[model samples]
Target chain A: MNRRDLALGKLRGLGNSIIDDVENNMVPSIKVPSRGTSNIVYDEAKRYYVLGDRYGKRSLGNVKQIKKVAQMVSMGNFCKGLVNTEKTATIREMYYVSEGWDVDFSNQDESNLIVEDLEVTMGISREDLGLMPEEDGASVYGDLTLKDDDVEINAIKSGKSGYSISPTIDEIEFLDHGVERVIAVETMGMFHRMVQEKAYKKFNCLIVGLKGQAARATRRFIKRTHDELGLPVYICNDGDPWGFHIAMVIMSGSAKLAHVNHELATPDAKFLGVTASDIINYDLPTDNLKDIDVLRLKELSKDPRYRDEFWQNEIKKMLKIGKKAEQQSFSKYGLEYVVEKYLPEKLDAM
Target chain B: MNRRDLALGKLRGLGNSIIDDVENNMVPSIKVPSRGTSNIVYDEAKRYYVLGDRYGKRSLGNVKQIKKVAQMVSMGNFCKGLVNTEKTATIREMYYVSEGWDVDFSNQDESNLIVEDLEVTMGISREDLGLMPEEDGASVYGDLTLKDDDVEINAIKSGKSGYSISPTIDEIEFLDHGVERVIAVETMGMFHRMVQEKAYKKFNCLIVGLKGQAARATRRFIKRTHDELGLPVYICNDGDPWGFHIAMVIMSGSAKLAHVNHELATPDAKFLGVTASDIINYDLPTDNLKDIDVLRLKELSKDPRYRDEFWQNEIKKMLKIGKKAEQQSFSKYGLEYVVEKYLPEKLDAM
Candidate 1:
């Protein structure tokens, strides 16, 4: 049988075309594990198969077309054989997986491939990679002693070049001076706004969300900052619930990730700037007050784990005022207000 | 032993709260198949007993969170006294498969949980009464749909209703009316904007895409739309390839649902409007075009499946223009201009 028929018609029809790819030499841009079978030959024990055969007996469709599987693992490997044989290694900056077969209102059930994680694997070492690090992903930092001695640090250390991710491990290095801190902003849109106002060079900021989910990834990075570099971390989020939840997830740890990796929050770092205080502190707009945010705050406070000191106190402040504050509320403070109110004031302490 | 320590902790730390929830309630929010003993039970197969009665006398997390060997069946008819009370009834949705150790990612991975289709019931049936659809934890369209069609649908659809879901099945009927055309916009924010412009109310536009990521569920609704209402559908999407592909999925069908149900989109339906043509026709901004999106369009033009007539002509147009068009590009034309440009000027042909 031809490879296409063997891979599709005979092999239970994954309809994968990587079989022709393996034969023709289609190299993937990302890295695939040097070991393990391609999606071809299923493994009952591991519950998935190496998509293609390492022996060249089987074929894989082009790795790019295969969405559901961890194609990057196969792509970067086979791509070396296809496009470049001189270098066998390729680094992975992101990994996407599906929640699977997204069903819609129109009877269109396409595969729902969500970007699972966008980790900085280029600089991660196997030694640095823990089997299940107290966290799922690992973060690295340069240990440094900065100029500021009196200001207390409350976040993961900052001060790394984020011109873009360095492609190789060897290219990854420590910053020459420690005057600035590298605060990974999850979204580039937010970063651009911050930079337009000169928010980060003043404190050493690293723009993160340019490629990944940006928000959750930054939290993990900051936690890594805490562990690897011992930088104090603080979260400046919108006073609204979604923003609050994102910040809280960093603080409380995701239940899903709790099973997978570590949480990144200071035992003491707290949500700053976007507070009910911002509503009164800056006389912000109340049209933005959402009923759900109020409801969510009440729900969060009632949770047994958060009923204690920090959350309850913050929640009670809003309950007393019956107001909601959002990170956007600080925008009225203008770029200068954000820096002075939260960032610079905090940096001055640093 | 604490419930968690039992069964050698095989299903350890996996949604443990779900088990404690079962301990207190008989018909828990999630109804799991009984991990009963193997006595050649439900299907009258080779009746065997467990190594011990450990499988039969199981609880999600009671005296001990033990799942008996009996609980590991591909089919559930063998067990007696399942809480949902199915004697000959097939397993429709598995609540907490004692064996669901990993993430449920694909149709095939999920198929493994079922011994056979005969062992499980399929589709919504009159028999599945008294049970809330959401209780099954299966995908459900559960929210309100504002009747205004001009509103940028995606924006309101983007609103968080403390849920990942939007618009229940009952809600769709309210909007269907005598409308002759159904346009399922995958992005709702754009739909809401159109509503503000009085596009739907003015021109009888039936815009979908109030829910993101529920593409599969949305597809089911489309099947209902076509089968129940003979509306000629037209998919309006971003000019990029994924948008093009999503339109293809709605019309041509996807492999994942090929076996389960067929015929959501009609063969005669049109794939119209908001494609790469907008980049040149309207001069839309490229500032926010994701790099990956540009690459995907390039790849789409090259793929053999898409190289044929309609796709080829459209893709070539984009390449010639060298620009990507987002749905928002239509904003320049205003709702009136879009209807003037894309919609059939005469609907009497219908």
Candidate 2:
């Protein structure tokens, strides 16, 4: 099924409904999935928030809904225009477009809310509506071929710079590739070093740079790559609470973006390093955990998502030791040690 | 004096001093301007933080200062590279650059600190060091010609879109032009509408957009425009505590950027609207002030920066009314009314 056609069909249906309501002298109403956790149910098996059996109806008769419907109609028209022109817009661009149309988005948050409303109402993602966030997160290098728009990109042959994963992951199509696994690095510095050392060649895996917390597009791409290629995903982050949370976000999904969790999350992705146990076992240089780090570790220890015994023990050890180590700490050994020795050892254990 | 020459000379001096220390078997030391209010004297008449008698010296003998000196040297060398190459870098870019150079900038804040240290130590601003924040805040439309690098830009004649004020404001040289005043708006939407309506032509003033909180560059530009061009500046923001702070940041200077406040703050800039008084006087649509708004309002009521009796009364009245109005609320009077009626009325009152 073509998503553009589906989006266009939704817009046409809305237009017809509005036309019918005007002809019959009736106030039109739009039924959208209600926002927030109240309308979302946590699916334990799926490890994500799915839409609950609850819906919000916006009627033109109500003053607020009248404005809402006007905004919605404007957005629908805008989406229709995007499809017709074969163009894409970032969320910021969408806000500016709506602003130009006099649809009063006082802040980006208001614009985001309407976009979310549109997503729920049409049962379509924003990406399908030709809307994307600013290109952020995920840098890839490995034996993978990707078709971004009309251009086929050979990730492995893209030189030292690697391919920047697009935010519009839905628009990307993967070609047959020989990549065996995917390793996602939290920091760009580490990712660059891995590339410089040609770690991907040795490991027969794609190296994906998360660049701190993984963006939605990065997570989606990772999930798709894993699912489509039957590749195991491994996360390498700092041996800190923040790093643990990053891995948690990839595996179980983030609470803030729970609405799109199932699509974004790679639940089977494994945490490789730098783990708290690795710091002691490898005799890595450590820095005293700051007050904030301790607080975060304590919170993560109490979090249900981190209830696994290994994770619990790691957090406990970090708290007890009052120290943390970064992925860069492996640089103390040598530049090549992280890619050559540390990563190889971790993979062997796995 | 050329800032690059000054920066390079300072770097050379530091290098020679270290060499001298090694020869003499003495610990190397550096004197930098001490941070915080304790070392910052608030100049009431000037409305900025001036360096006090106290200065902080980092020495190799001290464990903490050793790390601080190392970070500072790394940053200084990085700035030297930027100057040598005649290139500009955003704060984030500087962080990444430092990471590439093996400087441990774990986060942006750490990088920001080193930048600040360089500023204080060398008696030079980040802008002078060829460092800028990301391009943000301030859009402009006026009878003004700006020389950004070699490209000449006529703000008034630059098509209907107007000119976005660049983050590298230091590089912008204003050509001889006639403009009565500068009106800096709080939001981009309002600024765009004002441009669309040709409000600048009607009022014979330069319109500058401060998108939400004004960025340092925007503030610096506003200040320089006021100083060099001798234009009275007027700030128009929402009638909320945050809006009040934005105005405060413009007039009295922010504590975080105290060192560069004198260069950035337009002390004579007047707050035009939307004021709490305007809510009552104009009978504007008001939303119930959230807990955060109330809390901010309460804090502003106690802050020295907001000590103006009129400003105090306005905040007090907002707390009493339990309501706040956005700048967008003027849309109730229609789009053209803000430019034609409300602005004229406010200007008349001024």
Candidate 3:
């Protein structure tokens, strides 16, 4: 069955169970995997966060749980209607859609939590349930042809700006490509420069500009591209703690989104510079590390994600140097310095 | 000559005057149009802000002005290099690009001001000088086909997410389209629904999602499309004051960007919906007007941009009702209610 059909079947089963309980004169309850930090475990073998065996039961027998159960039921019904009609709604729209139901949400955050609850209960993604995010995804450029909802687009030839990774990237199929690796850059300035210089052509790689910490769809797109195409994923971000965190989230999994790490994280992905060594070795323009940056570095150094000798040493060196540099700092040499020199040198070493 | 040639000419003229002054032992001075509020005047005929004939002279002879003049010269040389090399730099990159130069900016803001000063002095845009913003522009979808750097993309057929209005939209050519009007929606949620339902096909219009306040490229793209294609531009936003301000900025130009309003503003564009009348007439789910919202409404009512009877009436009605609604609030009726009922009624009235 298609993802939507599977999600529909799960939704029907959930509804039938509750109805069966009511018919048998028993209290209706739903068991959800607890999503607390304590329940989130770092899986060493798989190299991403996975849920531990912890369950949170919500029953209609309790007065306080009645409203939440009602809200979940309303949301489930809304999702069913969306899947049945072959339409989709954003999280914001879902919140607004609840206004018409008997049990409405007080605010968007409350509604968002219930959606997460529903996801954990059904073991399905919100995308399969016909829900989507409001923001657009990454800016992808290269020789890859992406097929979205049956529409084929040549990423590089499409436009000067390249292809925008769609929010509904679950349906996007990587039809064909002529690339060796996928280099995901964090900043837009660096990404645009790479596109202008056609850096991907020289390296035989696809350039994915994350814009910042990537959106869910962007992470998923990168993960899918890596798994399906067998291309190595390299993350290029600023030489700082925050940048390291963003890279780690993509490589491993973030605590907040641990549930879906299997679908999002690219454990095999490599972190490319701006490393502390590169900062010192290249004599690039630098900024003084803030207190928060130092604190984050100390924290990351201890985290299991950065347990590797390279990451550990880099974190320690950064802390010792007390400096950080951005990807755009290479513009000091010239606009094409990063793509022509830094990237070529880094890639050759890799 | 093309824009790049024109910009180069202006840059050379500025350089020549300085060299000529030094040769003749005269004080090198650059005359810049004062961009203060006092010099920014609303053009009634043009329906946008225009710079008045107030000049600010900076001479190298003054001790305080030496650094400023040096910075301006450095910026001019940089722009010339960009134009001659046919390379573009983001304002952020421009800041870093100055590190090797004699006069480097302390921060991005100082560099941005110099670029603006260069624009006002040269009477040419940064785009003409091969400079771009760091952020990407709007998301557009519909029947329109855009030709960028000699590459054509059919917006609807391109991808599921549509065409991302390129950051360097100055180079994009709107070749041809079969659409009647362009509907610019302020929110992404509404725009996504419109795209999902093929609402543009039924209305014979192009849908441009602004994401919030539009970037300069988005406004330029819309203005160019309106001027070149003879398509009426309609703005659809929320029922609150902030939404009205966003629409007004697109239609009449904003104060901060008065210098480039001639190229950005779409004066003839109509505000289509989420007005006070829309909130009451359609009975949309709304939130109580915050203090800030009320204050903005009062300010807008006094502003000359909303002097029209329709806008003035809506402002007063919104204050009286003390309510505000988002475009997504229409989802309370059903997912299709907007494309089916509300939009058609609003379009008929227009």
Best by DockQ: 3
Ranking of all predicted structures according to TM-score, beginning with the best and ending with the worst: 3, 2, 1
**Which digits, one per residue and each the tens of the lDDT, describe model 1 over residues A1-350?**
53222212311212134444455677322332222223233223322222232321221345543442343233223322322221211111111111111311111122111111111112122112210110111122223322211222211232111122211111122333342344433223334345434555555543232222223334545555455565555555556555555656665554333222333333333555466655675676444446876788888777543645756776778767777643433443332455556666645643
Complex DockQ, candidate 3: 0.75
DockQ of each: 0.01, 0.04, 0.75
> Per-residue lDDT of B185-278 in model 1, one digit per residue for the tens?
5454344334434445555655664233234435555656566666666666777777787776565454333322242334444667565555
lDDT of each: 0.38, 0.77, 0.89
Cα lDDT, model 2, residue B201? 82
Candidates' RMSD to native: 25.3, 9.6, 1.6
By DockQ, highest first, what's the ranking?
Answer: 3, 2, 1
How do the residues B1-350 of candidate 2 rate in per-residue lDDT, one tens digit apiece? 66668767877776788779879998888888787778776678887657776788889999877877888887777677767866655565566555555547777788798889888777778877877664333557788887754556666653333455555577678886778999988876566567657788888899887877888878888998889999999999989998888988998787777777878888899999888899888777678999999999989888777777888999999999998887766656644567888888999999
Please provide, for model 3 over A10-42, each residue's C-alpha lDDT reduced to its tens digit, 9 standing for 90 to 100: 999989999999999999999889999899998
Better of 2 and 3 by lDDT: 3
Q: In model 3, what is the error at residue B166, expressed in angstroms?
A: 1.2
Which 10 consecutive positions of candidate 2 chain B have the poorest summed lDDT? Answer: B158-167
Tens digits of per-residue lDDT, candidate 3, B1-350, equal 87778889999999999999999999999998999999998888998888999998999888888888999998888889988987899888889989988888888888899999988898888888888998888888888887787688889876877788877787777778999999999887888899888888989999999989888889999998899999999999988998998899999998777788998999999999899999999999999999999999999999878888999999999999999999999999988898899999999998
Candidates 1 and 3 compared by TM-score, better number: 3
Once fitted onto the true fold, the runs of candidate 2 whose alpha carbons sit more than 4 angstroms away are A1-350, B9-27, B99-108, B157-161
Winning model by lDDT: 3
Worst ten in a row by lDDT for model 1 chain A: A90-99
The window of 10 residues in a row where model 3 chain A has the poorest summed lDDT is A157-166
